[model samples]
Target: MCIPPEAQWKRATIPDRRSVPFFGQGRGLTDSQSLDSIPPPPSPKLRRAQKVAEQKAQRIQDFKQRCGPGFSSSSAWQARPWQHRIAIEQGIRKQDALPEEMEVVEDPTIEEPVGINPVQVEVGEFEEPTVDVEEIVAENPCQNYHCKHGKVCELDENNTPMCVCQDPSSCPASTAVFEKVCGTDNKTYDTSCHFFATKCTLEGTKKGHKLHLDYIGPCKFIPECLDTELSEFPLRMRDWLKNVLVTLYERDEDNNLLTEKQKLRVKKIHENEKRLEAGDHTVELLTRDFEKNYNMYIFPVHWQFGQLDQHPVDGYLSHTELAPLRAPLIPMEHCTTRFFETCDLDNDKYIALEEWGNCFGIKEKDIDKDLVI
Candidate 1:
């Protein structure tokens, strides 16, 4: 069933991984196995988890002993044990300079109870409410089960949450032109949702495997890239990357377009008043500017690689990972495939950071691992 984003995001508890018991040969002990014969947890991962849980329980017990039996810590306190940290964060911590009104949850009073979770706080008193496990489960049966882009979670005949392919018609109509995307099939989709939902229907097919979101906008005719033009593709791309950074710097807005580290790096480029402005300069002009301001292009090359090398993040980008950069450029630059294929150099079907850096004309020495940020 299709659900609105606001409704789908409703907060409710669902079953967690901890509740499920691991069952496998030589993993979990059999019920018939005698207590003495039982092995030290076969799974090192499970043993680590148990050790961590035991340490937490011991710490909580030690804390209760230190604070006295009457002192009952809230659930949040039991979870994090950070009454002073919470108080300091919420600006209610009592210091020698501050008054009693600025008291931390560690020093609670009957007159003014201050702690985490307002639901647990009953006006002037704090009490943990009796929870109805069934009721919470009913409200959020699908909470733990997240579906992919074109699917939604719904209870099946057995009342178990399962992700189903969403109907393309259920997708909301695009309000702007840019929302319409072109797929690798050279057909324009109403929106990304329409494309993904349609693609989901064709799952496990030869067509589906080849299909991908080609670009951000509708399909348009792009002239074939010749051998000579293909050679100059990198020149134009490097220039574009540098100019994109400069444009973003000039329009300095902290809408999370770039991280603080990225901002600091771009700030240096922005300070250089001699940097090229945003425009459709000729390839010859672009090449000349790249030679004149070579340093400005290096980080942008690394930055683009970092942006795409995120799925598994092993310092290597697979074909799927490169899709975001490649798919968009394919419709505009016909040399997109040839250029990337050339970058692989070894034809390993994966592009490393070094390969990506070299493709952009960055010197072998300048392509440092430290610049990947």
Candidate 2:
């Protein structure tokens, strides 16, 4: 039969101990665990716990010194004996050796967390659209000149102050010609023209371009043609073209004192002026020489070199004094080739009239058949 439930539990429990001494108690089973030999339970004071906490703190610091971003520089790991002693005594991390990579434990004095949550944004304030005001156009006050009742005074081309009239006949003081031409003779003209009395009629086409000549003669049209000749036409145009080219290609003396073309032209002019001054020949023969060879072909060449060197338009250099120059342009042996090259007649050594025609836009066939190279 099963023992009663309480009686079985009582068997598992030691019988009431009336006879054993206080230490010799529980189990004759273990001598070491006898009641008198049983050791006291650990004290509530936690001396081991304190030691364990200190070890754990030491381990944490060692871990930081070895693995933190600034690990090598940490005082705990620093090779300096004094630093090591300080680390051991203080048990506090050095601020200078604090790991850059570590998320520092927040300290109110040294490492406070910033409040950086995004601010709540409120939306839906509507702004009124601004309207731009336009400038006002004032009315033209049309004042009446004839009857003193006009609505607005009219403005003239020059925007001068003037009265407007409804009737032309009533205002004699307000004399105005809608279309007018004024005439004044220039006192600077060498001689007065009796034909157009007050003003000399400038001999020009309706389009205002002056006429040119085929040849100079004791022609009545010479004065009207601005004293230009068929012979001088090419000379004048060449000089003008040379001047323009010189003007455009001109550089300051600092950049380039004189260009090759300019040097050639200056030399040629200098040579010609020297020839003219010797006066070994009659003026008539020289005049004839100028006229004969002028328009033929060499006129352009001679004219190219035969003008005064005016000051450069950009004003880099002051006007140079032009004296009667006496330089032999190019040695005689190379002069012929140099002349052709200077003219760019062939853009090569050969001097061909066809090439000259091509360069100057003149007809090749029109070049004088008798002209010599």
Candidate 3:
């Protein structure tokens, strides 16, 4: 994800593809708290402990719902209570939690002294454990440093962490050919690590500047794009894009995958009686629908460009910026490479917003910036 130290910041801004979607970013709270059960006996300490555990569990569940999907609030209280961390970890954000309270459910037979107040016991009886921050760092200084892909963090003589290119041989070997990748130099490498490490070695040279990952698989012959095929490429692509969005809208009952503007745009396509549903349709049908519903495809075309143009939010797209979309699409859509190459009409090594729209058959006058949102 980076070329060198100078380029590390750029790739750091790109979100990791592995993250689950976060919904209601600004919403402060979720209404996930459930009605609590009362303790069998009337000791206030037991009652308060039950109350504390219920509140903690409710907050944990709310966090799950905020992060979204596969996390629900109906589970029983945890077997153990939250442990108090005397010193917060370097990069971890702190969350609200009671310190080292034993689970009331796990130790049901025990009882707190009837006359003692739990609040005073928690505050006055307990003291924060003294920990040396330096000892933690001394154990593993490299753990806190952020290293880009193809690089590893290492401790120097002074024990300061720094990024260095990783050895390709250290990368795990796989027997499958699918693990292989081809670089822009047309040389096939064993894996992504091998490819990127090779690139990292080339650092600040002209060849390094020129070299990039070509595609996901081993290099092979890609047929040249004929005039007719290039023209028809957008027909299937636009229809496919529109149907994808519509499908997301229909299934997005709880996903919140589409934004407000995107939902509004896709609603038109979802409700249109003439709109094409996703399936393997003949080329003639694809072309016919493109002609009939030309307006529907325009926003999808521009929206895709905006999605990929996010590293620096510039009007142009570099090869690195296009990798998220391009790498996955290339194997299925062979024309993908030639289509994009031809899109850069001025041969500036970057595709501007106008060139992208033109490639998808949007008229120059109809390519509105408002549609990109």
Which candidate comes out best when scored by TM-score? 3
Cα RMSD for candidates in order: 44.9, 25.8, 45.9
lDDT of 3 by residue, 1-373 (tens): 2122212311332233111111122222122432243333344433543554455555555566565656443332221111111111210222222143455776456556546655324445767888767644336777778886678998888978889988888888857988888787989899988888878878889998888887888888766767787777888888878877788889998757888888988888788899887888888999888889888888888888888887778888988888877776677777888888998999999999899998888899989877777
Cα-based lDDT at residue 43, candidate 3 = 41
Ranking by lDDT: 1, 3, 2
Residue-level lDDT of model 1, residues 95-187, one tens digit each, is 222332443557555454446634444564646687767644346689889787788889988999999999999999999988899887999
Clashes of each: 0, 11, 0
Clashing residue pairs found in predicted model 3: none
Residue 246 error for model 2, in Å? 12
The parts of candidate 3 lying over 4 Å away from their true place are 1-148, 153-162
Model 1 C-alpha lDDT versus the unseen true structure:
0.70
TM-score of each: 0.55, 0.17, 0.58
- Worst 10-residue lDDT window for candidate 3 reads 82-91
lDDT for model 3, please.
Answer: 0.69
